[model samples]
Target: MYPLDEAARAIVPNLRGAIDIPNCGHWTQQEHPELVNTALLEFLKGL
Candidate 1:
């Protein structure tokens, strides 16, 4: 659904981080709601 991660990072200068949810697709929250929510919570807590 998008460019390769490395290519995306190179194209978008402000890309800061990633949460790799293996085997998930473009709609991560819809595809893996629990995993996505957990990752989002962890990310927000760190900030």
Candidate 2:
């Protein structure tokens, strides 16, 4: 996933890179809303 994500970042100029959410699967936002929200806010703040 990391390599695939990196490939996506390379093609998408505005992509901020990948974030790994520990102990979670496909439904990351539902399972780990706090972690997801925090990361999202941090990414947005950077931009």
Q: Name the best candidate (by TM-score).
A: 2
Clashes of 2: 0
Q: Number of backbone collisions per candidate, in order?
A: 0, 0
Model 2 ranges off by over 4 Å: none
List the candidates' TM-scores in order.
Answer: 0.56, 0.69
What value of lDDT does candidate 1 attain over all alpha carbons?
0.79
Prediction RMSDs, each to the true structure: 3.7, 2.0
Query: Which lDDT value does model 1 have at 5?
Result: 68
Candidate 1's residue-wise lDDT over 1-47, tens digit each?
Answer: 34466787888987666667779889998999998889888888988
Give the top-scoring candidate (lDDT).
2
